[model samples]
Target: MASALIEEAHDLSGGAGDPLVHLPDTATALVFRTRADGRGDLVVVGPRTRAAYFAGKDLAVCVRVRLRPGTARPLLGVPISALVDRTTPLAELWGGAAVRLERRLTRLDGDRRLILEQLETALDARMRGPAVRDGLVGAAAMALSARGRERLSDLAPRMGVSERHLRDLLTEDAGLTPKSFARIARLRDALAHGGRSSGLAQLAAATGYYDQSHMTAEFRSLMGVPPGAFFAGRLPALQRC
Candidate 1:
């Protein structure tokens, strides 16, 4: 599981520009945002295939908990596929539980650590529930994120599953096909070294892309901008949930 984050944007008042964020392929985020007027909202951000624009209001505080791949479906009580490329209010999914959580958060004082602890506890409880674990999905995600590029066809036989079965498992658990997940894994690996890459060609080679053009096309399709624009600081820095 990704670590929880509590971000306070006290400086952002009166609608400051929010940065564009590229959500990762393997996780979903549960975000709780509170504005100056004491209005709080809860949202579940599903796996995003593209970059998203977000900004905070003045004196706003945001708390986020990121759920690991294949875990959100059980916690959210719905298939991850239902949430792909969308953000839905927590109330719509969790109903009264969402309301109770918001109320508890609103009543708390400005203790970021405490807030994070509470959120983590909530997630822990959900994870400990009767959710069936899919080891194959987790293994597939690990393989995709590993140092070397792995072909799904080859990986499937090694995992003792057929290629079609592997695809179905990934779709049900990760909300993505094997090919798409691998693409995202490669993209993330490249972006992690964005600050130090000598050039596009070098980045492409290091990230296992066919070439610079292949990397650029994937970057543009997923990030809404080319590598040049993204690395130039035109887009907002990615905030991991």
Candidate 2:
């Protein structure tokens, strides 16, 4: 099923003057940048180990589709493990083919629907990756992405595979160890509850921390900010590049 490999496509654009703050994320995404001059770039935003801050964009619009785990390898034409915590331009990997695709996109003049369709067609043409979909990795990733305290040791047995084998598969296809994926999933849950919760302590407990303190430490560790400031939109000083 498409849902197993593709998360949701999203429009990440904001006010032209507002800086962008991207929180830590567990998935890989195809970021399509459309600048004001009717030409731009298409880049792969690999998984993030921590939050990232970007200066305001002069681009007219930006859209992204977050690909589910276990689905990007064929499209990338490289081992997923190589992309961890890195951003790469498609041209570096796809070469002239990538350049030709950009020319096609530039000719579209930034029409959102057309741009998305073009990208989708290109992905659909990939015979193995997203099209056929990797069953074992997909199932394992979904289980871990549920944000529960599911141990790989327990999951491995249920799936009829050794824990080491499962770990290796995910590390290669998902570009993250089982433990790291789980941590990001929990952070995602916390973010979903950020604005709706009555208080930070309650939110932390609800999202699976031992207590507020445990949650605070993780927030700092992965996102470089305490939950309070993160939820309040008051990020600490970060060197924006």
Candidate 3:
């Protein structure tokens, strides 16, 4: 089923001059933008290694299709590693093929359902073609996304591959090394469980950190702020979008 290949497809509307913030995330997103002249543009937002800020003063409403791991290479026809921390137009990768899809989406403008359906259909078609991806790599990514406690080296033998091979494939397929992906996944879990716990220490313990200080160190490294500062909104720019 396509469920394993796609996570979610949704639309977002932003007011003029609005500021947006995104935390470190590993998922690759395919965003659809419709211009004022009734034409569509497809943008590929690669996996992010750090938090990013965007000031979209002249933004338009857009639809985003967030993809699951093991799906980007086949659907986009590129190595995921080449896309880390980068944003590219679909036309740059697929050339005329991308332009044709944009025209199709433009025709479906004002019909969000049709636009989304067309995107899915296009993805399904692309996925049926040849691709260089590893199912084991996808499995490793999912495992890390769930707990962030396993290592590629540890998972390699189970997947019937060498540790070095698994690590290399992971970087190529997921745009993040096993360790880096795990830390981001751990941070995601911290954010999720952090909302329920009253304090950082409790949240740390719940999310598999050695202690609060350890979690604080990771937060500073990945999020640019310690848990206390980030959670308490000590930095005005740290607001969640």
Candidate 4:
């Protein structure tokens, strides 16, 4: 396998640790990063390939527009469900409007600088279109909020929506239900912290799993590997100071 492409990101504005509002560089997934204080949002366009994390499916295709970083929240303006989560092409999502950006990456025709500038301008504007379902979109963003991720049952009640209803909303906006999203988010957090050396028991407890086996099962389903085998060689590089 090739090494994962890591970009030496240039800070557009604001200082470091502001907040990261980045799109997946591997797919059209929008990610809101509140991992560190003062880190601004880092909007990224994912590479065209299947996500190593999600087996047997194509990653979503879209641009992540980072506005600010600080705990996940309802983005207020962006649509949640308009984009598909499974292997959809970005060109199909934007209907050729993003030709410049795509061409630079695929055809290598235009100046990447200009393409980036155009994308930035569009991101700065508040999104508006017939395809956007703002009410549910806002709710979805709120669902992923820092506090919301911790309390699933409480979230639906607070929103005056049923648990099933909340799941539907999440599926529409995020292409996954609340439970699934929470699971992935928790797992990602655990991996980020534990790396390879962390055992199944530890990762399970941190993510609220009932036992190590449960976490192991989920790991296989989502990541296509058992917990132990997944981190065999990569753990050392992922450790934190």
The candidate scoring highest on TM-score is: 2
Worst 10 residues of 2 by lDDT: 125-134
* Candidates ranked, most accurate by TM-score first: 2, 3, 1, 4
Q: Give the per-residue lDDT digits (tens) of candidate 2, residues 47-131.
A: 7878876666656657787886677776778767888889898888789878888788778876877777777777666634344
Which model is ahead, 2 or 4, in terms of lDDT? 2
Better of 2 and 3 by TM-score: 2
In candidate 3, stretches whose alpha carbon ends up further than 4 angstroms from where it belongs are 1-4, 15-19, 35-38, 56-60, 131-134, 235-241
Clash number by candidate, in order: 3, 0, 0, 20
Per-candidate TM equals 0.83, 0.90, 0.88, 0.55
Q: How close is candidate 4 to the true structure, as a TM-score?
A: 0.55
Candidate 4 per-residue C-alpha lDDT over 106-146 given as tens digits, one digit per residue, 9 for 90 to 100: 33223334434544444334243233443553455445533
For model 3, how does the per-residue alpha-carbon lDDT over 13-124 read when each residue is reduced to its tens digit? 5555565657788889898886666568799989988776555534355888899887887788878999998889999998998899988988874577888888888887
Q: Given candidate 4, what's the lDDT at residue 19?
A: 25
Worst 10 residues of 1 by lDDT: 4-13
- At residue 30, candidate 3 shows an lDDT of 90
Off by over 4 Å in 2: 1-5, 35-38, 128-133, 238-241
Best by lDDT: 3
Instruction: State the C-alpha lDDT per candidate.
Output: 0.72, 0.78, 0.79, 0.42
Q: Is candidate 1 or candidate 3 better by lDDT?
A: 3
Q: Candidate 4, after superposition: displacement of residue 138 in Å? A: 4.6
